[model samples]
Target: MVKMFLDFVGDKFSASNPIPVPDNDPLDDCSAISHGTHVAGIIAANAIGISQPGFIPDVPFLGVAPEATLGAC
Candidate 1:
């Protein structure tokens, strides 16, 4: 499992002063381009009856922390 800590400094940090996060597009091929999405999936896939027919059986590809939250940086 991975843990993160976010610290806010300066007097500018306040409830009224929200940070602006710019919108971004996801990579077209998450599996091909980066392992980030795959790692995230491993940390959050539901593993509900999905399987690889030829390779494995019964056990689903569940994540370490299925209920964990996700965020982009």
Candidate 2:
């Protein structure tokens, strides 16, 4: 589902104004891109219960409910 959504967004947006693919090593020279920062901001900014994309990257701040039970599929 996530991949499909991303693909759709990429196809739609790329057709008009292409967004460059994220470099494999975005942090090698951090200043070269804002993708990392943008992702971090989104994850940290989510207030609702939705597990938005980039909602938790590292082990630190995992979201608003770090202790909530996450059931298996």
Candidate 3:
């Protein structure tokens, strides 16, 4: 049930995005290292029933609805 605002692109303000979010102000990029990507994973990432290296669980990692599909965006 989570939809992360990982990449924010607006004229006024950008939320530490990877690509350039053009505007009057600066890009305001982050150095936290894949923070947005991590959050994006939490929102809607799928495990694909694989065994990842770092995680202990069999599924490795999952979102709220890992294999679910939502018609509406």
Candidate 4:
């Protein structure tokens, strides 16, 4: 579902993780675009794996409100 939404948006919403020079750390290509997804995950992720930037796989993203409904315009 995440991949589908990303593909559907195409260039409109860029979530490309880029590694920069010197520091050699990954940067959020578009934080504004990422913010919404992060918020949504916190609300209704429903047993999502923790592959996010700083999170550990063993500590997954258990939703704050797993039974919550989500909507978007």
TM per candidate: 0.43, 0.23, 0.38, 0.36
RMSD to native, candidate 4: 12.8
TM-score (C-alpha, index-matched) for candidate 1: 0.43
Question: After superposition, which runs of candidate 3 have C-alpha atoms over 4 Å from their true positions?
Answer: 1-32, 65-73
Best lDDT among the predictions, by candidate number: 1
Tens digits of lDDT, candidate 1, 8-67: 333343478766332232212223466777678877887768776694778666688888
The clash tally of candidate 1 reads 0
Which residue pairs show collisions in model 4?
Answer: none
Ten-residue stretch with the least lDDT total in model 1: 21-30
lDDT of 4 by residue, 1-73 (tens): 2221222332333346343233222232455566767888788876665466666666755678887666432
Clashes of each: 0, 0, 0, 0
Which whole-number lDDT from 0 to 100 does residue 16 have in model 1? Answer: 88
Stretches of candidate 4 off by over 4 Å are: 1-32, 48-61
Residue pairs with backbone overlap in model 3? none
Error of 4 at 70 (Å): 0.4
**Cα lDDT, all candidates:** 0.57, 0.40, 0.53, 0.52
Q: Give the per-residue Cα lDDT of candidate 1 at 72.
A: 32
